[model samples]
Target: MPALDKIRWENYARNLAKGMTQADAYEDAGFTRSKQAASALANNPVILQRVEELRTERERILSGPTVFDEDADTDNGEPLVEVTMEWVIERLAANVVSAQSTGNHSAANKALEMLGHHLGLSFSDKKAPSGDEGKPGSNLGSGNTFNILSLTEGLKQHAAALEQMPMKDVTPEDDG
Candidate 1:
């Protein structure tokens, strides 16, 4: 068999990297449309290597940071840093600390929760069985032990107290 044309091989590899089907790419590379021929060409060691190279190059280009300004270039910019799992975790940890220092308990809690979830230390709403089933004052086995009646009554009382109390502006001022 004669060696494949360099242009056709490059075209086929480019098409494959662009998500084209083997048969479609082979045809687009100026080859006769035959499923068997396309499959054979696609499975060729040289073609497969070229396709992998193209895919890797495409990924490198896509993962790079984008520059919005047409006149600006990234040639002299700082080295590109890939976003890793460790980097994300560190940022989240810093956020938790920063929020706590600023007296934002809610934000700190949220950041801590996110960090916990990312680290696989997730908190679940489902309660574990306590082996206290059928015991007095133990509502184990039945989902949720809190008294609904008492909860509703408490909420009503709290609402009434809030209505009786004087309202104050609690919104934080923008530091920016």
Candidate 2:
């Protein structure tokens, strides 16, 4: 293929990696807008390989640990740490305690809300209908009703389980 065509193909693959639709990527790569041509190129083995490479590279770049620094200059400050899900949860938990100690019920509730969400608790505005309603021996109550003590215990158990699990290392070098 010509050098310009190769460049266009690379651009098309890059665009695909960036989550563009095949037709959109083709047009964005300077190719005339044609669904048939886009489909054909998408199916090409060389283009497919290139697209896969670009996607893998993108994933590697995105999967790196995130570092949050309050100051732009990192020469003389606290050591940088990788911000993981556990780290975020710890921060939220701390915020909840801090807010509660300061008599900020609103802030404490907000922190607890965020912590609940992070812990996979579903907070739906609408309550789901419990099919057991109207059945014999069924304790009929609001569908959204839950035992706060049990829920809190369950969350504690879940947090303990998560703590026991090993964290996965996702560095690019580990791919090999």
The numbered model that scores best in lDDT is: 2
Regions of candidate 2 where Cα sits further than 4 Å from its true position: 1-63, 67-78, 127-144, 147-151, 154-176
* Each candidate's clash count: 0, 0
Query: Positional deviation of 124 in candidate 1, in angstroms?
Result: 53
Estimated TM-score for each candidate? 0.36, 0.36
Query: Looking at candidate 1, what is the lDDT of residue 55?
Result: 73
**TM-score of model 1 vs. true structure:** 0.36
Cα lDDT, model 2, residue 109: 77
* Model 2 worst lDDT window (10 residues): 71-80
Model 1 ranges off by over 4 Å: 1-5, 66-176
Please provide, for model 2 over 41-156, each residue's C-alpha lDDT reduced to its tens digit, 9 standing for 90 to 100.
Answer: 99988888777776665565457775654432222122345677877776666566557767999997787778766655645554336776666434523332353344467556
Error of 2 at 44 (Å): 53
